[model samples]
Target: MSVPPENLHPRSRLVHDALRAAGILGEIVVLPDAASTAALAAAALGIEVGAIANSLVFWSDDEPLLVMTSGAHRVDTAALAERLGRGRISRASVEQVREATGQAIGGVAPTGHPAPIVTVVDEDLAAFDQIWAAGGTPHTVFPLTYDELVRLTGGTVAKVD
Candidate 1:
């Protein structure tokens, strides 16, 4: 169900507020069931898995790298690193993810992080007119256009897989 900003989970509220501050009007929606995975989120939303923008955090050169990748594919760290001209990028540990994003592992959003993260938007996500992303929790999600996601995160568009 759609949740107004005041009624959102604390973490989700952060996302809601962030979205509002960024001039986004889409309200956060809570799923009846937790959708910790992209496949599950797609099933619940009745959308193609490719339309789900998976918020992934990767550790690169001792910094947090936020990758908004398409749910249908996996991130190729080696290629990504080479493309980004960075050192090896590895999946951040749960604790690291939490520390970097101030949110949990299962439902991290691209925005509302403790600090601005170097973000990458998967070019594949642009194929969808609308994309869904986690709203700071596994049971929450929000919708926006591909351009909005890029603007929200100030993410560099690139091929992630």
Candidate 2:
């Protein structure tokens, strides 16, 4: 059985409050684990892999770039670096991740960063009717339509593969 929506983790509660303040209406749901992988999350939620919105933070030189990618495609780091006109692209360290996004590794949400971040939404994600994104916790997720995500994050739609 799943926990009630009102009984959310603190991080997820923060996410919910932030989303609402941003004028976004979505429902947050929590699971049992950090769910570091989209496959694991999809399996647990019984949703298609394509519906999982994997929030990935990449270190683009000295800046942090957030990519909301679909579980179906792998991000090409080198290509993305070239596309972004960055010298190099690398995964962010745990500290860097926390500092940049104001959230821990597995719980990072697309919004609610202490500062603004350049965001990119994978074009592949548009194929899904609804996508599940991290709710500031590894085990928490929220439902969003593809267009809503693009609008909410002010994200550029790109072919992230």
Candidate 3:
């Protein structure tokens, strides 16, 4: 069973608000257990792991770049940086993740950040009709289409791996 939106964690409530503001119709679903990793989320939802959209933060030229990638593949940061014509891309630290997104590492949502982040949507995610993304908490997730995700995050669609 899913909890009411008002009863969600404060961080999740921010995500819920962001989704509503974006006109996304999907409701956040609170899982029975924490789905911190893509594999765990896929198993919990009984969906293909590739359908899980992992929200990852990377530091590029000392700025935060949000990369939403399919769970089935690892992001090739070097190739991605070259494609973006940016400097080296490195994973953000835990503190940096929270400072930039106002959420923890395992539960970073595409939206609801303290400020706008430069975002990239993996081209592979478009293969799935429905994609699941974290809802600002380990126990929460929401559904979205690849187009909706790109629009929501103002992301550039690219091959991330």
| lDDT digits (tens) for residues 26-99 of candidate 1 | 88999999998999999999999999999999999999999999999899999999999999999999999999
Name the runs in model 3 displaced over 4 angstroms. none
Q: Of models 1 and 3, which has the larger lDDT? A: 3
User: Superposing all C-alpha atoms, what RMSD in Å does each candidate have to the true structure?
Assistant: 0.6, 1.9, 0.6
Which of candidates 1 and 2 reaches a greater TM-score?
1
Candidate 1: where is the Cα deviation over 4 Å?
A: none
Q: Candidates' lDDT values, in order?
A: 0.94, 0.83, 0.95
lDDT of 2 by residue, 1-161 (tens): 33454687777777787778777788787777667778878887899988998999988867988999998878998887777677787888899889988888877888777887888899999888889888887888888889988887889888888
lDDT of 1 at 29: 95
Candidate 1, lDDT over the whole model: 0.94
